[model samples]
Target: MESMLIEKSIQGDVASFEQLIVKYNRYVYNIAFRMMGNEEDAKDMSQEALIKAFKAIGQFKREANFSTWLYRITINVCKDEMRKRKEHVLSYDVENQDEGSMKENIKDESTNPILIYEQLELKETIETALNKLSEDSKAVVVLKDLLGYSYEEIGTILDIPVGTVRSRLNRSRSALKSILQVQLAEQ
Candidate 1:
């Protein structure tokens, strides 16, 4: 069914493309949000990536994984925007997130106001640290840690070797630990 949609999409069928969008929109938006670190930019980048995907559907090989192809496009779009801005100080707009989004990850602790506060604080700190990372390192961390993609999968998405992925993830993790330690100590 997905292959059919892809074929039709490649043939310039807007409805078929919309069907594919419906299936992958959340995934694309989630990656965009993580990379952009804000809702507004995420939405904009996600839309831009989807538009690019629609335009390049013919170049998509049938043997390749659709999600991976889409992810590469999304990441490239976000990275291009990041490059243009040349600003790493991203603000994670937690208050603006929908109830069903990343906010849901901390919902289990909501019953305890203290835990909720602590969770939010930690989340913000982590997001801040993540935003400080280089685009390459952050992409590795977001894909492997936050998005739960395997090492091989991340390499495929980022067009890097598995060893490179492992090394970047290691360095990114160390950097995040150091940043978190300093942040926690300051509080």
Candidate 2:
């Protein structure tokens, strides 16, 4: 079903493309939001990525996973925007995300107020640490840990070898751990 949609989409069928969008929109938007750290920018970047994907559908090779290709486009779009802005301080935009969005998935199931507060604090600290990473490191961490992509899938998306993906993820995790330890100790 997906291959048929991809084929029709490649043939310039808008309806087919829309079907693909329906299936992947949440994933695309979540990545954008995590990268951009804001609702507005995420929306804009996701839209731009989708437009780019539509325009370049013809260039998409059938051997590659369409979602991986789309993820690459989304990451590039966010990275380009971040480069243009010359900023790396990404904050969690949990307050602004609509209900039932990706934010819900990260929400603590506990209704205890203290646990909720602690969770939000930890989330903010993690976001702060993530913001300090280089874009390449951040991308690897996001793809591997946050979005649950396998090493091979991350390698394909980032066009890097699996070893490189593993190394980057390792370094990024170490950095995040150090940052969190320091921040938590200071609190």
Candidate 3:
């Protein structure tokens, strides 16, 4: 179904292109949101990625999964945006943030104030540590750990070697561990 749509879209069928957008828009936006940590930037990046993909549709060879190709485009768009922002912090829109998987592990029957406070503190610390990583390392961490992509897939997405993916992930994890330990000690 997707191949047919891609073929049609590449042939300049506007409806086919719209169908492609409708199908993958949320997927693209979610990836952007994870990398960007905010809805506004996610929306902007996803829109830009889709436009770029559409413009370059003729060049897409269809060897890789469409989703993977789209993901690469999204990552590049986000990285470009990050460069423009020139900030070390993720915007981290609280209003748009989800509880995420971390919440499930920290949840229990009792909603004690102290526990809640500690959990919030832990979340902030981790977010801060993540935001502090270099953009390439942060992207590796997000893609591998948060998004569950294999090292090989991440290599393809980020256009790096699998060895590089493994090394970057290791470095990122080590950095996170160090940062979290220091943060915990400071508390």
Candidate 4:
């Protein structure tokens, strides 16, 4: 089914391309939001990625799943935007704003609101720590840890070696621990 969409899209069928965008827009936006750390930038990056994908659809070799291809494009769009901004773009406040939804799974009435607050604080701190990482390290952390991609898949998505992905993940994790430890000490 995806292959059909890709084929039709590559053949310059605007409707087919639009359908592909509709299918993947949210997925792309999510990745963008995580990478950019804000909704507005994520939306912008998602649209840019879709435009790039539409233009470059003919060059897609069918060697990867369409979603994977979209991911690569989205990642590149994020990295490019990051380069242009030359600053940390993640907005920890977004997480705080979504707390109501995040707490929906905590059905236990006995759960402490104070504990939840602490957890949210910790989560925001960790997100801030993530922003401290270099873009490459951040990307590895997002893909491997946040998005649950395997080391090999992360390497494929980022066009790096598996060893590189492992090293980046390790370094990023170590950095995160150090940052969190410092934050905890300050509290």
Model 4, clash count? 2
lDDT tens string, model 2, 101-130? 332433443342324347779888887767
TM per prediction:
0.82, 0.79, 0.75, 0.78
lDDT value, residue 90 of candidate 2: 50
lDDT of 1 at 58: 95
CA shift of 166, model 3, Å:
0.2
Error of 4 at 65 (Å): 1.9
The digit string of per-residue lDDT tens for model 1 on 40-80 reads: 99999999999999999999988889999999999999999
- The segments of candidate 2 whose C-alpha lies over 4 angstroms from its true place after superposition are 87-117
Which should have the higher TM-score, number 1 or number 2? 1
- Please give, for residues 37-58, the per-residue lDDT of candidate 4 as tens digits: 7788889999899989999999
Model 1 worst lDDT window (10 residues): 91-100
The TM-score between candidate 2 and the true structure equals 0.79
Runs in model 4 deviating more than 4 A are 87-117
Q: Which of the predicted structures, 1 or 3, would earn the higher TM-score when compared with the native? A: 1
CA-lDDT, candidates in order = 0.81, 0.79, 0.76, 0.75
Cα RMSD (Å) between model 2 and the true structure?
Answer: 9.5
Off by over 4 Å in 1: 87-117
